[model samples]
Target: MKYFGTDGIRGEYGGEHVNEAFFEGLGAAVSAHLQGKIKGRLPKIAIAGDTRFSSEPLKAAFCKGLRGVEVADFGVVPTPALAFGVLKEKADFGVMITASHNPYTDNGIKFFDENARKASDEAQEQIEKFFDEKISGSGAEASVKKVDMKSHYIAKMGSILPKGCLKGLKIALDCANGATAGISGEVLRGYGAEVVEIGISPDGKNINCNIGSEHPEALARLVKDSGAFIGLAHDGDGDRLVVCDENANKIAGECVMGLIAIEASRQNALKGGAIVTTIQSNVGMDESLKKRGVEVFRSGVGDRLVMRLMLEKGCEIGGENSGHYIFMDISPCGDGLAAAVKLLSTLLCLKIKVSEMSGVVSLYPSIQKALKVARKTPISETPTLSKTVEKIEREMSGNGRVLIRYSGTENKIRLLVEGKDSALNEKSMAELVKSVENDLQ
Candidate 1:
């Protein structure tokens, strides 16, 4: 079976695939690698989790297996906080037990390094291979400890913002009632933004209950009615972001990534003026940025792939159309709050509304549709699917682009279309999405 997908392993809580035995096995395998290689006194690892009901239990199971790794337990923290905790303590690795934007029934673990960055594929591959072992060194090791995982993250998170940066700025934030619920308000407070927070309280069951970036109507209405300058909405684990302007009109999530990319380049934070993203990214971005000589690097669908392309290109910012944005120059893992803060800061520096800033590069119309498959089967293994994809590719060439790929986090196939013509895009999108739905759904 497959343990590592595009991002990480996720399955239903209390299910056979993600039960206690598997989690412990995974931990033991990964820890065995560090035991001999890492020359540290006490092998330490940081831990964190989201507000999913299953996350707490899974985290407990995971930490029990990663014994001897200086374990710190950050309660109901977002994915970024977990990664940040690892970076702050200067540990060998960190593990955050979260499914990240998936519904409440789903839960999984994502690992990061001491730098708060996602673990390299090579390291992850090695761990995957070892997970099949019957026995490992850390399995019988001793010394399990659990400490607070929030303070260090708060300190490091606070370090990046300038003093009084948001002193008089008015903003509204929707925490998605998930991972970043507790910390989102406090972090904004540190910057002194007059932050009006929604979805700040999460009982384990209430994670993404119609209250996230996925459902922005609530936040949008609140932002417009409150006369707020901006609005930021985060997903379950706060790894992705979405935003709105003063009028509560959404700045397309893809536009958020593009805005940051342009800003990073202008600020010299992005090296060589190259930005890495995926084919699913809006065509408008590529068209607009090319005029300015800003390079757009394309990668496979997944935050991990975008991140890899970013490093390979030595670019600071990378992301996808799905809202997953990475700032290699800032944090290793995608941090929604960090991205929000940067976008807010960019607004501060430019003194422009989000709509005004986005007008610099207009987004082209594109269509994206996902079809859920009945079972988990790698798209590469389906010959019929492959042929259908080829047919779509042939039909869309020159006039537009079509991307067919399996979603990293779900049992679904995604069809993306983008081009110069709106009618062609919608027609192709409907055709492909319908075909895929019929074939696989």
Candidate 2:
């Protein structure tokens, strides 16, 4: 809770808190914590990183502090690959160095337990406590071995869909010049799709620069110009995805999940006939799924919380609105490439193009505002804002909803209001933004 954010520990690379010394200390503390948690057994950690100039040095420094631990180094891989490698290698856990959609100057570290899922909050707290205690080690005798998971990950994803499932289909991919720069194309092509690649040339600083899921406009244009059947984009870590239909219409992850829920319902594959998503997801998804005899459950704003609820609620699909779709039927964590493959497979199976399928779910009007705050005062501590939120919810009376929370990675508070009536929703959102500023100021 102290060091980890909604997803992981992220900050500007080379900053005082993110530099080599800090990571080295983190490495020692995490190794100690994991060792204890795993019953005094020697923890075998699978460490992987994305394409950032600072990643390699940080990883080396972190591993340096591991001392005598067995570290399997997966050189330059996606975050999901690191998660999958944890299971594939049967390691005690996994560590990934990436900042997801953050800018190139920023970097992060995410941990996955042996189950190939995000480390539990309690586990993260334990690691943080050890870090604060400043565990000491000789920084020597750490066993760092290199392992290649690219091909293995590719094979596993391909096995999910039928053989030659994407034959004769064309898809465009923007890999964000990060983890999936060269890997996504290889995997998609291996699955028989004609792949057009962009953002594949990573020069360290170019990762996530005007490309990837955060910026899908360029990818949309490419998809339309190249006449590709669909376009998919991934963030820096290749853990989240943004897609474009054949008509260059951008599709949010909520809509993607809705469409998938429909398909799953048709095949009687919807686990417990429910879908899990985040509070940030659109209300339209809820209404659409309800019509299809599926229920939608909301979790906190991270894939970790989504997955946590999925397990608890017996739901098979869960994801955030920021293109982090978790097809629990396939992968444990949010995987851009895996989701794209499944989307393609769905398209082929239904004999429909992305453009035609995009209309399956209509998103309601939603507005989001991010207000700068000097500090992250807990919502409960701000009685005025908390009460206002409750009052607004009462006014909505189940017609819509509101979510206000401080961002885990940024010094700001986000306010989201959604409903069927666009005009009323906008007015309500403006009032909520004012309340956030007043309360947090």
Q: Which candidate is the best by TM-score?
A: 2
- TM-score of each model, in listed order: 0.91, 0.93
Whole-model alpha-carbon lDDT for candidate 2: 0.85
lDDT of model 2, residue 360: 79
Off by over 4 Å in 2: 39-41, 136-140, 379-398, 434-441
Cα-based lDDT for every prediction: 0.76, 0.85
Tell me the lDDT of candidate 1.
0.76
TM-score computed on alpha carbons, candidate 2: 0.93
Instruction: Determine which window of 10 residues in candidate 2 has minimal summed lDDT.
Output: 133-142
Residue-level lDDT tens digits of model 2 in 1-441: 788899888999988567899898888887777766666456789999999998998899889788657899999999888988999999987899888888999998888998999999988888888889987443355798999987788778767777666788889899999999888898788778899999999888989999999899989988988999899999999998899988888887777878888888889988889999988888888877898898999998889999999999999888888899888767899999878877776777678778776477778888888898887888878857888788878887888888788889878898888877788788788777777778787
